[model samples]
Target: MARIPTAELSRYLLSGQINRQGCLRLRRTPFLPRRPPCHNIRPLSTTTPPTSPAVVVVPLRKQLKDQAKALKSSGSSPRKKKKNSDNQTVPGWELTVGIEIHAQLNTSRKLFSPALVPESSLEEKPNTHVSPFDLAIPGSQPLFQPDTLIPAVRAALALNCEIEPVSYFDRKHYFHWDQPAGYQITQFYHPFARHGKIVLYSRDGIAAEDGDRIEVGIQQVQMEQDTAKTLAQPGGVNWLDFNRVGVPLIEIITRPEIHHPATAAALVRKVQMLLGAVDACTSGLEAGGLRADVNVSVRRPGEDKKLGQRTEIKNLSSFKAVEDAIIAERDRQIAVLEAGGTVAGETRGWSLGGTETRRLRGKEGEVDYRYMPDPDLGAVVIGKDLVEFLGRSMGVLPDEEVEGLMGRYGLTAKDAMALMLLDEGGRVEYFYEVLGELEGRLGGEGKGEGSYALLAANWCLHELGKLTEGEDAEPRTGLVTEFVAAGDLAAILYHLHRRKITAKTAKALLWGVFNCEVAPGGVTDAIERGGLWFQELSEEEYAMLADKVVEGEEGVLAEFLRFKQGKSKGYPQGKLMFLVGKMMKMGPEQNLDPASVKRVLGERIEGVYLPQLEGEEK
Candidate 1:
């Protein structure tokens, strides 16, 4: 628990500034940490910034050069190369990261108005969804909407946040074109929830041991209204789409527990999945439904007394950007400190194209935005009824889902996380649907450790995943629904499990079924129509195939003989096994048990080559 200096804290707490040439304003900052200074001094600018405070904006060219140098130093090339172990930080320093994520709740109407909220305001004409309140009409008064509270509480529960019994709203003053009211409504003084934790796993897919696991603490979860977007039209025109104005948002704040770039990225990803699971928000980062602001600081390896000055990177669009920004910034700061220059406490912006960040503004020089409790909206009281309803209706959390899948289906941690990490919920739904159908077909469940469950898991993640990947990854639609029904997929896997069809035939059947027209007699019928039926070879047939392979390749026989004499460089038994595999696959439609084929091949090889060895010894 390092203490941040109060003078430095002032820079982060207050954000208001006036330009010498003109009046410039920005968005509202909801809350700031309050830590008293060890020694008090006269304040510089508590309410407004003084004129011409020398704001040092990093030059674009310098930033670009830094990005290039960083990339080259990190060994990035035009062609993708295997990630080097050097990417991890050196042992002398530690990285600290905290995240603030804003997710728009999935609601039809605005947070405080009857205005309909569209997924994208760009899709509709300008201002079509705007209500009087959205436009800041003089007579319209604010109305508190309660529907947004349920989802917020649900999200808090999913994240293990402690819900506040009473929550209230406040107005943060900032003048912006998108904020027609000259202020934003948010829960700052009294947020909806606080003090939660998110668990993190290591790369090995095993939950880290209790002492080793990284558990990021949730500082607070607050409800707020989204501002409108200032859109640029064709032909030098710009307009405001108020459709997004006043839309509900849940701001999740995390404690500075993340120490690695990869872990920070994983934290964001896990939160997104959890949000989607609880139906709080869609977690579509590209579509603007969710975004994160990262706070990063660095300190000496063993120093726990003071955290270095942190810079905030705002509005990262994707998890990749989050990871990249943290790494780049961390390296940049360390380089600056090593060169005897100080790291600036300021806001920065990340360019997705360049994979770097640029200075937005100096934190110390910014002006403060005044905040006060809103007069119109009363405090919201969460009763037992609503809490009970939320507790019951809130579905499986992301972590719980992973554990359940692993326990019930006997899946590996990696496999479980693969399905859980899918951005599209349909993929997860389809996986379980197929899993359930397969389980039922396999005669109820004892433990999913059986061959059928393992095969189904592979097909679901690899083959079915491939089919559902790309722009059309939506579940239960198009190819997912049209071609492969759950029952059909389950039947195919079931037949493969029962050894009624070889793995090769089953794969062929799956692809053929996907590309084929509607089958008149279902998947089994389609398998028959496509001539994918497995043809099992008898014992005699197996022996004949093995004999043909052994007799046809004199070189292979020579290698086997050399191995028997202990003269071969490598194991001849391995070569023999390889030959057996090739011999089995020679006939495409032939389905012989691999064990049976191996046994027959061993007999043929021994009968033919052992006598030669015996003769040579004599």
Candidate 2:
């Protein structure tokens, strides 16, 4: 018989516990590798084996203390403190964050079964959208759905991922009430797409012209089946909602590259935009259409190569929660490490109003889940032609759209981002449609594109956005688009640009049309019906009105004259505007332009009032 080497025995002894009599015995754990049969080997130690089968367990806090002492005694020095983006500093720690986003694919059918994917709304009934295959009944076979592939591919391409020609699925075995099949079908060994990047700007532009941006590396985007939702009822009874079971989901994993809390939130927001742009997912965090799992860790400043223990915060439903959870976890880890303790790797849950993350369970390793390729479902073979077709149909991604808005329309980065970030492409489309109409009507003959583009962006983001801002219960954007046609808005802007209507009159017209208070006719009809057109006044008329107003308001005229002569402590321009407002109120039906009124008032002050005052003083 072969004998076990002393070195091997020593290595095995290191992993086990030493009894009172000095007998070394190994404890079997799911994560550890299997050892050789004990009957085949002779005992090397003189001490007898422990009589009891129970293994000695050490407290986790004590283990952490011992590890911290060991590291301290090893002569390792702490690194210098660093400042984060918010200018906050932890004395000797650095934060690292990574996000796992699971977005429900926007397909009619589930991922594996032929059952319909539920709407997942509050009014949806439970267990109505399930199939025999989803429940894992006997004689039911798992079949892959081809409808989910296109959206997944489009999303991967939008994130700049490289799609694999052939990818296989694996079964991650676990026992949970929500998992009806006792295992989740996922792409474990080989995902469909990998190696992508999402660039988050510090401000609004894709290029990050201010030299501040984060390039988060995408590890992989894999398709998987979502588990059912388990709702806890009274008296410890749990209700299962199988409506969401077997729903198609694409899990996007990112490399641990994020550091700041805001950056983490920005990455989530950017991912939502990308997925929504491709129409691959609903990307609505509130409706459970999208969920995020955040992995956060903290290390010393110079330990970039060596990461510390990370904890996973699961199912953060909102961007604010994502940022706050990261910050809270980071501070918790720093506190543990600074107190001469070690941080544990575990899964945590965050409440909406809670300040700290609560422990859910210990983190599971790959070995614990016992991952293996699915024998029933064969490999997914994607053709190059299909990939190319999906890529062609991707239309335009969010970053590309932002660049187009900036370059083509000469919009500021802030304005462009405002339009794009409102609600995917709706506001941007409205802006573009209005701008296109304006360009067609007023592109030539000394009409500047920049001015019209700015006008359109302002109206879309400010005016139209205000109408649909808080109306989240309804499809407010669709309602506004249906009611206010793009051509009508463009015509209103064109008339305003041509100096034929006052700015106030244009705004009132927009509000009236949006509220259905005005007729649904064109801008010309609305203006003509309301008699809101600009009433041009000749120089003689303006000068006579200016003289009449100046003569009527003696006190204001005295203040204006004194200010012009540097003898008063009041704003002469404001007094002039007050008089111009009085003049405007005199002709209520004229719809006089404020700019023209201000311009003529300034001319009267400069050419008439000041000269007259100088003559009187002389």
Candidate 3:
């Protein structure tokens, strides 16, 4: 007989026959009560149940081809329809959501073992900062630095979590090309901090509203080690960055209670604030060291339909990406189910280039996260005193900063909030200092809130806002703060509040600060030293003559009569103050005050508003 080829023979072996009568006909599938058969294929084991938790393995070549052929014959098999997550469909399907946020702890050294460098000084290079522990060589051991725990704990407390008196670590085994260390040291099941929370606000700045005030619950925040990153190149070979290996990571989780994508976005933003509040990490999204892996599922409204298998969107890395991925995934699933198909459980990646999410298949129930206590590192025992200390010292909370602007100063809620929120680091504090000085110097008993400081807030926040973003952004974050400090702000405010300089001229003065030969001076100097003066000088002088006027057409003394009425003719109180500002520039130092111009103006006006001498109160 002709020699049977391996491919042909293999087919015969499965079919139990070899024939070529045009096309060999194979027997139809046989069914047995003992086997839970599916898709025209018999189970590999005789007594397997359809709902059993055991892995489903079909006979390699035969099962795959048969399923494909059957599907093709029917055009396509019907897929299971997906329900809404909140179970808030038209029937009000509720969408139950929980999230897992993986933020790399900001540390001078890596986790598991010291490896990562101060990302500040060095450019990110593959394996450049790798230590022996990162390499996973034989005889390699692990270590944990105490400093890493502080920042991580601080951030958790800022998230409003209560630190557990005792929380520990475990090793989770999962094999990946990049993780040649065989297993990863992780904290699973139980984390260091539990029941933490994240808060979100309304777009309108209203704390309470329909789509605002989202609060997501915390499952637990765990500390773990990060795996090295792989950068895939065009070729099959991948470039590796081991420098990040063993980096300490904090895993923050949430309850599956959030119903909307907007809520997910809000939760991430809250975490950013929490990080900043603790001063543990920069609240920047574009940079690494912060990443959130979002867990999502869908269900139809009112169905109580079991949560659709959750699909994890991995490495979202940014708040914007988190929002975008949730939306994209929601829409993608809706489209599939609307077309009558089921969504398989899997992991996904957010494509920065495409702004989309792509699926990653799940082959097993779990990676078996083969968890065991970390051998190299010991348990962390948190003390009550240390927790208290960190909480007090934890950095600024955005909301509290806003409140400070309102209560401590005379700013309107809007302006004060804008100032602090616009610039957090050192800038808001500096503004508050200058505003305080202005208040002390002005000597107004500061009655009636929401009028003056609010105005200052508007000016300060507006200027700082212009500096940070938009196409017309500033090159310096502190540049405005510095200018505000040198008392130039004082001079400008003096003029503005005194009504001496028009509001329009006040802005012009600031613009001048941005690009003049002055290299950015304070508000006061900008007015004093600048050759550009917004007011007309002689007109001011002409008004001053009222103090000198003979009260009878002492036209020659008309100038003095005008002066008797304080500064000039037809000038607003603000204009007179600008004249005084001029005086200060022209007069000796320490003999000057902006408000004094006001007092002097009011007194002279009273002196000149005198009896006509022709005898008339008229």
Candidate 4:
């Protein structure tokens, strides 16, 4: 017999053959050494031998290849599935999301140390705010701060969470350069609050339709310490700033009830508003004061009880990032399941501009953390009376303020939400101050009921918001509140309300007040000094002015006629406004109300100009 090569013999061994005993067995060449049997590799069939003497066992790899070949022969490719659109969820799949928000408490001192918290973390020099306890000095003991508990409890109450009478801290053991201590102390076994709910509305600056309401549940609110700020250098070196170390943080964990990305962002915004309302956490994401970690998962629509494996996108800094990351992660998991792959539970990080998340590390279980009660800290206990007192002392929350604005002033839901969410607490105050002045000055004489309040809100939110919006798009309501006093703004709005000044003149007067060109509470004096009063022309005088503008600008009149006859591409209303603008410019010293001018000019174009042009053409 010819000797078989080693490779040929191994191939034959993988493809078993029938022996003389009528059993499948590996065939070895005579020149090759005998190999030990693999007891783990069982036969595919253990039945009695068939009538045929030959038997062959196909390997798993060969079976897969044969199936792939069959698919190719059938003119189908394994990689040709339909792709999903960006905004559409995968068909037959449902997404579930939860967020963990870490908001730095507005406290002057550290949680367990006496280090003074920096007022501005970015402006303060590094290493200057660190305390001996914050650096993990051997003998320093953890002291609980009572003042920090006030804001924490207030936040819990604002979220409608049930306050825990007693809570304890546990040490989560981890090794990292940012944490000088070997373990982090946090509320693990018992959080301070639980079972809260945040009601999100469509008008809450989210992506829901009108009248849509979603209630997201709060799992728990636990107090924890913030880690040090880690700044990485260009050359693999790292700098640790301990200013943030031991800073008080409240980790707000929400239940996996959210189904949409925009809802998750709205929940975060509601929390920010509530916290700011209660004077708890004034710092926002830009200042490293608030951070959100989103957990996203997807499963088939019928699998209500069973959730797919979730991956957490950590440390999202903005509300938009929170929304986009959840969306990207949801799409990613859906694609994995569709492509016949499993989604592993892992931690992920999102790049600022990237569309997908990158794996940070494998998900750590409770055993990995090696959690134990902190020996240095004792249980925290709160009395029922203190909770009641803090609840009573809490300021008007976002929801209450929104409701009040809508009920009292008849403001729309969108307008009410906008007022509450602007510049923390200052925008609302300025609005009320302006309303008060308007109420005193106008006394509901020229406007409808609650119209003064409406006027005040619109000017504060629209005009002032636009004027104060600098390069970064954040409204400098503080600067507006500082320079443009409520009385000054109210004075200008008062003149506009009484028809003494046109809207254009009112806006110019506001700009003067905002830029400090007008003296405080001297809007009347400025209007008098500049003779900025509305020129109230009678109907006859207005028609004369309108005719003067139309006859002088024959080209504009022809265009207006063309537009009116549907032969032009421009807006007839715009052309009419152009005529009104020309007429207004003719009397620059007298502030003309554009509304009156437009009305008069529109009548001339329709009642007089169009008939003349049509008759001339005929």
Candidate 5:
């Protein structure tokens, strides 16, 4: 038997432990072949991030069966599962959870405050956008945000939420190191809307899960002003970013009824989609924008509907992160229960490397929040008339707008949706308006009049979508001003619709203008210049070609006679198209449709490639 290689065999033997990333790495044997080095063993880098304290689960497939056998045979110390006097699991695994999502309201001004100078005008620095009310200096007063509230009210009503007649703004008092004002302006007693549910969908556009069909219950939705962010440091110091200090935000507080992590994730996704569905929201979880604070807890396996001590995971930016944090906390609590230990209630931070939850701090209840009414801004009067006006006048829901566009303009499904998605981006409606005028022009000009909606949709989705998609910046809808005259696009499309020019010709012409290959109108004029026939075959040229063919060979006359008698055989028609192409090659390069060439050639080729060839004996 050959001796084991010392360096290679070192890994399998008991050896000294070397530290790497806080995990133990075994030392390799000093002896080894110098040329062919041991490449298999990699040095563990000490760059792993710190993780949460939790029992690690080793993955072993048959370990559980082995455990059961040992459990059955061994004598062990008693480990008692916690139970109440009546024999119920104390702080039973049953726990309730709810999500409070705070979405920034898109408006020109801040709520209960005047909008600041535009960020573009200010020098590059923080806290520059701060108005008097934002700084919360003595005697600083907040003004009402009417325009901001309109969209907010519209959004809540669209969610099928119940709005209060007399909603009030309140002060959520707290003294965090970041709180310059000593409290945040918020709502508590009565919020703007309540009992709304958002259907959740994932990034892949699939609903994750459902607890209750139709609507998940929302507890309340409040319109409030946001606090400034505290940029904290590791040592002790933290700076303040007041750019977002007084921005208007709407918080939708949910009920503690979501049954699973998947259902919860799905709910958040649907809310995002619905917001998009109405053009009331940008995509969710934008940079330093919309966020959710999740309350997580699990119930016992046998418990019907009981809740356990819930923990809060605050201000997760994305839905997937929320899903992960919830599952981690739930599993951690389950592990504690199974180990004959009790789980404590605390705010948790999620460690991404290993799916586990860490205790960030103790959880806070309503008492800890210490909510009180704001002194400056009084109760908002949400009267019956105001509610009716706001609800009815909020603007059409996105799905409804899409349907209306489709119905009014006869747009295809893809085109209609694209228009609604454009929001403030495109001149979508203006395109349809021009289509109406084109029909009149076509009738007078004796051109084919295809349906304008289909044509417009084709132009917008297929042509324009491709034309502008990779632009360095967002395409300007205002660029429609250049196209408003109906000279460029209208002329090209009209020519095609009239069948005066083929689609290939129209497309080529449009591309030429767009690419500056030709002046915008240069392509349209070239059609007339090319002389509709491939060439202006003069009478002399035409007669000479026909005479040449007739005199070239007696075999040609025999072939013509065979074709006439329906007995010609062994011929290829594709070659005839090539001949026609050659015949026109020296002619003007008009935008010729290959189909027209095929059509003309079929008549001349006779039964060459057809079932009955020109020389066939049939």
Candidate 6:
């Protein structure tokens, strides 16, 4: 349970204070109790909380024991697993994975070239957005886009990366049709930021060491230019679309900290969410705005000292694909090793259906890139003022937004996370707007018995989730034409909450509005136009319907008589309900209250039907 001090350690790492042996000298902090100086801290950052006092030196033994006890009491510590009845240990394989995410920066032009990288929806023809510089024509010079730093620095800060004061570009040379320049201008030697970490949790926000959480280390965040798309045409022709050429991108590289494929997938999703939260990238997987290159390796337990040869699965499109590709590659590697075969280092592409990966090419060494300084661009300096300005522009991220939603609207953590994750573009904003309107109508400030935040959240996530079933992680543009407005949704909830209509009626109204079967209108007006208002039968009407149901079902009546005489074996209540439902369905215009129906069915069955059955039995 020994924990490394991540905050202080990262500060040292960024400040170049760590020794050659990777040891940190802790400086004592004032106003905190002093502890004995100690060693034996691993590089892992999971053992200690980031909010721990900023004091440096502490005894490793005491810290470990204390943290262990704390974690044990909280049920968040690693525990020994008992063997199953088969007398075998849990399936164990030390799976190591690192992921590199390429996010397309939201900018008007390319990173180093002024050429436009057209948006995905633009109608521009192929190669229209390219400039001579992007085409690498002779005498064309490169210039850096200063606007790219806003998103890059924002992403760095959001990911807990330390922004470097000075960063420069280098040429990474490789031969490919997509890169007309024969080299990509990238931050190979000194990236914009380094030494960042992202703590990922389970779908429900579980902590690390709980087996469902992970702490992934970010190696660096670098700015680079993207290549154009190469397409294959019929008859052995090749086509290049330069619309995407020289587009700005940020490559986020992580250390090999992932231990499972699912965890890796979750880490990728968490990164995507963070990027989208900061407006650093659109992260549209289907639109090709973001992608992950997962590096996977495996070794047996207790062989931590030996690093296995790894394979890089390049450009898995979606989060699910990331998971599947890693798992497939890991299994493939483990199989090869178990069969007394050597795993080769190579680059592979995800298969057509994402079931497996195909070999792309042998992995190249660093020398192959032929790295050199880019003479066209000078050192990019990020001053303190620029850093502060970019930092302020980073709005609330998912973590903070989750807490804020929970605290403000009295929602559970799961509920909050659901809302944030399924936000489908502006759907989250629409949800909050509806919640506000509902609060106003309820005559409460989200307090007391009338607070409908929970109800609203359930309706939105469940009902709206069904509507936008397969929306990508990125927000979708524009509202679906059939969907109801926030004000209308609020009105629907108000009537349902106030007992003005049954839950069934409210659902019907919502479905109608959502499908455009009923035009947009006030909740009451829509209800009336659709004839969906809850209907309460009069005493006489209820009696008549109950009598008619019994009279119409002669076979069911006989069964009821036998059951009353203790001759038949089934419950009469179910039979009565079936009859009632049949009658209710006969009139679609009438929105009957189910509770009232149940009441009438029970009364008729007990008072009128029971006596008649007893008389018949006699």
Clashing pairs in 2: none
lDDT for 211 in candidate 1 is 31
| Superior by lDDT: candidate 1 or candidate 2 | 2
- For candidate 3, give the lDDT: 0.61
Alpha-carbon TM-score of each model against the true structure: 0.78, 0.77, 0.65, 0.78, 0.56, 0.72
Against the hidden true structure, what lDDT does model 6 obtain? 0.73
Error of 5 at 170 (Å): 2.2
Write down the lDDT of every candidate, Cα atoms only: 0.73, 0.77, 0.61, 0.79, 0.59, 0.73
Worst 10 residues of 2 by lDDT: 39-48
Q: For model 1, what is the C-alpha lDDT against the true structure?
A: 0.73
Q: Write the per-residue lDDT of candidate 5 for residues 135-207, one digit (tens) a residue.
A: 5655568888777666677768877788777778887877763555788888888787787765432331222
The true-structure Cα RMSD of candidate 3 reads: 16.8
User: What are the runs in model 5 whose C-alpha is more than 4 Å off?
Assistant: 1-99, 115-125, 141-143, 197-213, 229-239, 256-289, 292-304, 307-362, 404-419, 422-455, 458-618
Q: Report clashes for each candidate as comma-separated counts.
A: 3, 0, 62, 0, 23, 1
Candidate 3 stretches greater than 4 Å from native? 1-92, 121-126, 199-214, 232-237, 353-356, 363-367, 406-427, 440-449, 467-491, 519-523, 531-618
- Which portions of model 4 miss their true places by more than 4 Å? 1-88, 206-211, 303-305, 444-446, 468-478, 549-589, 601-618
Q: Residues 1-618, candidate 6: write the lDDT tens digits.
A: 335455444434222245433344455579766665323221212223365432243333455467667778889765553222121112556777889999999888788778776876234556667676886765678989898888888888999999999999999999886787899999989999999999876653322333555577899999999987755534444445667778999999999877766677777777877887888886455447788899988887776577689999998877657766776787788788889999999999885333457899999878999999999899999999988887887778888888787787777877777677654235566678888888788884444532687778878777666554545322334444226788778888888776678787777777667767666666787777666666567767766766766676767766677787689777677777787786576433354566666687677877887787677767
273-358: candidate 1 lDDT, tens digit per residue:
88888888955665578899999888886765788999999998777678778887888888888889989899999895354579
Q: Best lDDT goes to which candidate?
A: 4
Q: Give the TM-score of candidate 5.
A: 0.56
Candidate 3's residue-wise lDDT over 56-102, tens digit each?
43433445468657766888744533332332232333445578877
Positional deviation of residue 355's Cα in model 5 after best superposition, in angstroms: 8.0
Candidate 3: Cα lDDT at 27: 43
| Candidate 6 ranges with C-alpha deviation above 4 Å | 1-92, 204-212, 352-354, 406-415, 423-425, 444-451, 465-483, 511-523, 529-531, 537-591, 595-618
Q: RMSD for all candidates, in order, please.
A: 12.0, 15.2, 16.8, 19.1, 19.3, 19.8
